[model samples]
Target: MANSSQKKIAHENTKILLALRKGFIWVNAFYIFYRIIYQWNTFELKLALGYLVSAGISILLYTQINTMGKPRYNSKGELADAGEDLTQEGLVQYAFDIIYVTWFVHVTSAFWPKMWWFYLSIPLYAGWKVWQLVVKPMLSRSGAGAASDAASESTEGTKSRRREKMENRAEKGPQVRYR
Candidate 1:
């Protein structure tokens, strides 16, 4: 029974994880594409293309490493046996945040004084999303005099509460036996 519930939750996480991955990839791709087009009139075509190429290659490499190689899981789940994999994934995102913000700040501050806030948006938005996902757990683990129960952001798909409907179906695959 317990195993069934776990498998259901894993499946749910898989769906949300896939959707979030797709959204992030698309957002970054659009940013790179827009930057190249936006700079075409001012910067030399080669310079713009160079930026586009670099961003494109980085995205490709990220996808390859994340999908083809073993995936590093997030802290939200019991998916990784020892939690090491989850921590490594967080570290990778932290490094990415540093690299992205530094690069954006450097270039935007010098070339496009009109859009400095854009440089900050990438890092700030990422940080906000991380806070949503991790802040509760971090607080709970800190353990001061007043205790707060940890709450994780549950994606709509996560089936943590297995209904009696599911329990019966698990024993016999969904052919409904009403007593």
Candidate 2:
């Protein structure tokens, strides 16, 4: 039952990640198109190349994520045991990050002369989004909790109780009743 619940949670995470990736790709593509249209006359080579590369990378990542195989589990039948796989979701995440940064640079460069501070401040918003969506979830799943260790220690009592309960169950052995 615990394994199934974990599996369900992993499945949900995968679905959410996939959806976020696809949504970001669509938004990136649209922004690139809009940039190209907006700068049709100006034609800044650096900005153009940035947009083109970002779009290409995003599309490739999307394809890879869609084609990547489902994650494997461990002896305990937990997806967390799988650690990290690189073929799909990981690559998509990396690609989307690149896309975001590239867009940030392009936009800032394009508007810097007219609105320097505003353009420079744009990345703060981008940084917040990246932290919330990408960094938080990835780190939480990876068990990188050194920063939160103190906070977690506050729950030591609850943890001890749960551990004690599990040990008691083991001592009692499996409750099996044959029909």
How does candidate 1 score on lDDT?
A: 0.51
lDDT of each: 0.51, 0.59
Report the C-alpha lDDT of model 1 over 1-179, residue by residue, as the tens digit. 54554455455545544654675566555545555555445655555454565456446545543453233345895444211131235555654554455455435533564454564576687789778779966776687424422332333345455655577779887575689
Worst 10 residues of 1 by lDDT: 79-88
Q: Write the per-residue lDDT of candidate 2 for residues 1-179, one digit (tens) a residue.
A: 66675466457547755775767766665555555676567657765665566557656665565445345666796575322333345545665565555556555545452322343444686698799999999989667676568667877556677878999999999999999
Q: Which stretches of candidate 1 lie over 4 Å from their true place?
A: 1-29, 68-179
- Per-residue lDDT value at 73 in model 1: 44
Q: Model 2 RMSD to the real structure?
A: 12.5
Top of the candidates by TM-score: 2
For each of the candidates, give the backbone clash count.
Answer: 0, 0
TM-score for each model: 0.32, 0.37
Off by over 4 Å in 2: 2-6, 66-96, 106-179
